[model samples]
Target: MRLWLNRIGDISLREQLITQIIVGILCHELTPGQRLPSTRDLSRRFGIHANTASAAYRQLESEGWVELRHGSGVFVRTSRPNAPLSPEMAVDQMLGDIATKARKLGVSDAFLKARMRRWLALEPPARWLVIEPDPELLRIVICEMEQAVTLPVVGCGFEECSTSVMLEGSMPATLPSKVLAVRKLLPTGTELVTLQVHPVAPELQAYLQRYMPEHSTDLLGIASRWGDFQRIAQTMLIAAGFAPESLLVRDATKPGWKRGLDTTTAVLCDAAIQHDLPAGTRAIVFRLFDEASIKDLRSHEENLTTPDRN
Candidate 1:
């Protein structure tokens, strides 16, 4: 539906699912005592691998967020702090948006083929990261996303020594199992792309390319509405193996505040610029990384740098 998932930060699909269910239960979108879809059904519904769906359920159980009966199905057991009770409203609005997009396609056969081709050509990703210039509150959400996606993230810190943690090449020899997701940062002002993530959607790709700005990592030039961005980010995480942590949102909105307030209500840094800008003005500097597309320019043996120790 109109996913309340924040598109910013590096989250995995598992994290987003957990957030959705938790928020769903807390906000009454998913009623308490109602049975959840089996992990198989849920996986199909969410386009997730079944095993991953099962893991998410287990995580929810561990969190005391839901209860699993022998065969009765999973049930909501708790409400998260300040969770919205507007599930119905959110769903309605989300469906409306989906309808609008579908209608825009207008059943064009040729247009549909191109869209399908794009989807088919895309590869499954393994990692993602979101580095907000104002790193405080965003860090919390990033941490949650790492947990949700079950993938290690980078650039969460201003420190450079942790560079090895990135899926980047540590050596120039050997073959790696996969290419590392790398953020190609330029040294010059606007030439630099500060945020090392993927763009929300291809639909906004043209829009993003138009923006000329200076940064440490690339920023999404798409300029989509905040709500749309939230969805895109959620989708990326889900695809990359992370999920958003909606339950962690802290309502930082304040009346009469200007410039830095993020209207999305996600726990954003106090310097988010939403509170500082002119009304209707917003800035989104995030995208997800599809590690599969990376090239191993280094020795594969030492390429991963920090291989999964466990």
Candidate 2:
């Protein structure tokens, strides 16, 4: 049996082996009751640790894709008696067809596996947990995501998200900048989704384009508890030809954050902190998730609601 392994990618060698073998079986390249390579042979051929190969085989066996014979070797399971096609079989067929089409299009196995990982990551979790170190940003993310997804959305700091929450099958999401830190806090196999920073909303952009040149010398105050937002807003403003000196950025979490915004012509802040702005302050609400992100989120929610055939 031939197995493709991606050593430099996020997927472990064991998982790569298991996925490939399953694909092989589903594609009928490996017939039922066909003997598989020994763990030692697999280890040698794939240049993986012997233990990794053994673990892959063990997982395949536990999943009923293959069976291990004591003192002998592993083999694909023989056909069961008069059993209907299981969900697992259906999934395999679908995956096999996908692989065939992708191969025909000259797509490499590594690229296909990477795409698979991305889609798998999109699978809906039992709940959406927004992980933000700042309480205000956490609240903003939760509120925004709640509007975008139908699932229960909650917020927590990095430390507040305990192992129990992860064990409950929560999908922890965070800003792109904070993903690495969040991933380090989660258990292995936990999926960490990154919320993308979007450009200023279209209406806001239009307003800026229409009026900014007239008020080119006016101060543009930008406030948010999310550092990413502050930075993204600043970058976008500068890219739009707004003078850097005309921009006043603030981290709302800091003391006296509102001290300098009073002289600004307008303020841009996240919806969660909009209420904290001085009364009568002209504010343009900046959103983190854009239309594309929202569409992707809707797809994820659909995937979550779809019943597993297995």
Candidate 3:
């Protein structure tokens, strides 16, 4: 129940409710083996329309916050802070009780001041980061604070994300979801390339926590070698009633293709145009990988560019 409320942040009312649920779970107040309150219960508790409450719950479920069994209500996912923080996190929770008690008993100002002074005297935290579901999610989300193109990035072997920390989660690039991308960064005198994607996709987030032992959102870029996902996304758009005329193909070498072996990406886009791209289509370009792994079918491009000796 409280699990869904914790993810909301600076969004609409819908976002707040969702974040609250997530926060509730992360604080360990919602624990692993807990069942969520029904949608109806949440609606009545927060005075929201049932549909809105249902949407919030559904969104969280989609993000792997909670699960819904056929005959069972949603359950708190133990898998993903993306797990609760240490039990010691509860120490701060006592403040609420102390405040309540202080109000009830009218504690002396001197006593409260002494306690405040003691609290301020404590050492600063060793590390400070929002409790992430897993370490990978934590690492990736941290870096995504700036949507800068990664430099010498490595995936940390995070194949799937466990949580949706914006840019890092298994976010749908095609879907109208929030995602971050880094533009190339190069100084006039310095040639060092720098770019990074932060936060992680939900699938990658979960996987990183299970394997990698790192903390930083400085994610290595998802390999765009073959533009595999790009081709797939273009195809999907074509199939979904979006005309090729509306499609924007982007990639490494559209102009350089006439002379040699073409990249699979370019070939795929060209193929889509012949079969699917309407005349005068608008296609986006991708510039990460060079021709082969990127542009189109190299073999066919060779044939087209090969000198006919006949």
Q: For model 1, give the RMSD to the true fold.
A: 23.3
TM-score of 3: 0.26
Q: Write the per-residue lDDT of candidate 2 for residues 1-310, one digit (tens) a residue.
A: 3444545423466765776677557546688999999988877876778999899899999988999999989999887667667899989988999999999999999999999999676645778888888876678878778888988888788787756944366777788668878888887657677776554466566755675443267788999888867865665555344666878888998999998887888998887788899877898888767778889887876776787777
| Model 2: ten consecutive residues of lowest lDDT | 1-10
Off by over 4 Å in 2: 1-90, 93-126, 132-139, 156-162, 174-197, 211-215, 238-245, 260-263, 306-310
**Preferred candidate (TM-score higher): 1 or 3:** 1
CA lDDT, every prediction? 0.43, 0.76, 0.39
lDDT of 2 at 134: 81
Please give the lDDT score at residue 162 for candidate 3: 24
Summarize candidate 1's per-residue lDDT along 153-267 as a digit string, tens digits: 4434333323545423211111111112222231111111222222232322333244223121321221222443445444533333222332122232345443233343222
> What are the runs in model 3 whose C-alpha is more than 4 Å off?
1-11, 79-310
Task: Give the number of the best model, judged by lDDT.
Answer: 2
Instruction: By TM-score, rank the candidates, best first.
Output: 2, 1, 3
